[model samples]
Target: MHDVEAPPQERTRFQWWHHSHPTFAGITGFFAGMLFVTALPGAFVGVLRLLFSHDTAEQLFPFVLLALALPIFMLVKRKTRRFAQFMFVGMLVTALVVLGVTSLVLYFMVDA
Candidate 1:
């Protein structure tokens, strides 16, 4: 057996990656909200694509409307501080839930 020097400082850094916590949370929430919003259109298109044998309005409408709605919703919400706060909190929670559900589905699908 050979003697080895233990690096306690290095081990301490490895114990917790401080940089990733807030970044991961931000990224997770960002992508989750984006995915949730994007999927609304995707679901519509998937259905229409299946039914019509051709992609048309459904392929485009939901995404287009969602894109348009963001600005409109913001503008309307701006009329009241309370409403804006409520909308923001609502969207944040929704994003977290969407991320959670997406992760669960992916976990099971991958495991299976």
Candidate 2:
């Protein structure tokens, strides 16, 4: 018996990001997008909190807007555009859900 090894295929950093088929691509992209969407902010805030006081961190929070450039770049590039679209959708949905839940909670608490 003999075993043969396959040569490694070369892929760009993001080339293998999406699954082969569209269906799985969307599903995986959605979750991956969600994770990437959350992680950036989480990391920024974590770093700010570690390095600065609350008021300073609050003041600097707006700087996080700069992070939007990454997705914008991804969207502009042809290879990453598809994945970036899914990431954009995931980010939008996450923001909406967070606001909706927060509003409902505040409404219930304040109105009661």
Candidate 3:
């Protein structure tokens, strides 16, 4: 009887990308998007206050966002680069849209 050889298994194209760059890029993008939508503006205001007037609650949001985004950004930035930027922008836009929709809903609910 002739000996039979087993067929080789094919590897997935995305396996390496997922383990390598794409993973970090996706994460950084998420945090960047969250920072932009939730905390960036507030941080800017907070810094302005430090530069000019007394501190206020408005500044806290930005600082919070920065604290949250920095470490996340650093971890992924070196890996994904442009992919992270795309993710951040897309997420930020989505967040703004949701905020607007929520505000509209609240306004109608209050009026009724």
Candidate 4:
């Protein structure tokens, strides 16, 4: 007599997404960085307003500079360096666009 029952298969392990494709990783990181650049200052200010007086919040505003260390840390690590590079480029480009638009608006408002 032969054994007819089949052995049970092993369950697959959970895998997290890392955006393995270069283009996908780059685009995801870039947009995420752009959003971070635009939203962080406002979010910080809002939180400060909620937690402290106007003068205190204004004085503490520069603390936002500390956030820069995150990307710098990401850059220092080989694992996240590629994504960080794209993120940095996105942040710079977004900042430039924001500054350019703001300056143009200020100039036109002053002229008018």
Candidate 5:
């Protein structure tokens, strides 16, 4: 049996997950950079607040950790051409981790 080519219409159909569009990557990278930048001041403030209250300290500590992603991304990007993709993934991971931890803490604190 010989291999058959895909139909022309099928070939032209959009494969949403098969391609990494540059514009999409750039947009994601921009937001990721923005988020990384935004978290920095928040982490700084959180650290300062930590000095005054244990509760606030626990809540804010994670943000300080979250702020670390930006520097890590920058370092990784410096050595690779796929910086945008890296930034996008890093941002998403950072956001999810930070949000998940924060939500869990709040849930426990409220329940207690």
Candidate 6:
């Protein structure tokens, strides 16, 4: 019998989402989008509270927006899998950038 050479296995880059289920990714994206979206209204409320009323309850009122995530996710996820995944990842990235910039601004503001 003649000796036969075996084919080499293909290597794939390490991607956190690659090993995760699409449903999980989509769900994660939904939550991230919710958090990012909610933060905007929350921030506005917080600023208003700081400027006029000092009520902590009003400042924390934005937490209610978190509940909207489920419906939004359901609507978008039904449209397409790729779109949901992209939206989730995009929201997370946006949150990260916003947080970083805010931190830098606060640091400078406090120092000055």
Best by lDDT: 4
Q: Quote model 5's TM-score.
A: 0.34
Q: Give the alpha carbon lDDT tens digit for every residue of 20-39 in model 1.
A: 45444445445545554557
lDDT of 2 at 21: 58
TM-score top scorer:
4
Candidate 3 per-residue lDDT over residues 1-112, each given as its tens digit: 9987545443354445554565666666667676665666766776767776554655454555555465457447665556556565656677888899999999999999
Candidate 1: stretches off by over 4 Å: 1-54, 62-79
1-112 per-residue lDDT for model 2 (tens digits): 7886554553454555656656664665577667766787889999999999999999999898897888789889987778778878888887788889999999999999
Candidates' C-alpha lDDT: 0.58, 0.79, 0.64, 0.87, 0.66, 0.64
Candidate 2: segments with Cα more than 4 A from true spot: 1-3, 6-19
Q: Write the per-residue lDDT of candidate 6 for residues 1-112, one digit (tens) a residue.
A: 9977554432233333463566655666666676656575777676667776567757666666675575456557655555456556666677788899999999999999
Once fitted onto the true fold, the runs of candidate 5 whose alpha carbons sit more than 4 angstroms away are: 1-19, 43-66, 69-81, 84-112
By summed lDDT, the worst window of 10 consecutive residues in model 1 runs over: 78-87
Which of the two candidates, 3 or 4, achieves a greater lDDT against the reference?
4
Candidate structures ordered by TM-score, highest first: 4, 2, 3, 6, 1, 5
Could you tell me the lDDT of residue 37 within candidate 4?
95
- Candidate 5 C-alpha lDDT tens digits along 1-91: 9999899888778554343665555555657655764676676876678586867766666666765665566656644335556565667
lDDT of 4 at 65: 89
Report the error of model 6 at residue 97, Å: 1.2
Model 4 has an lDDT value of: 0.87
lDDT of 1 at 55: 47
- State the TM-score for model 6: 0.40
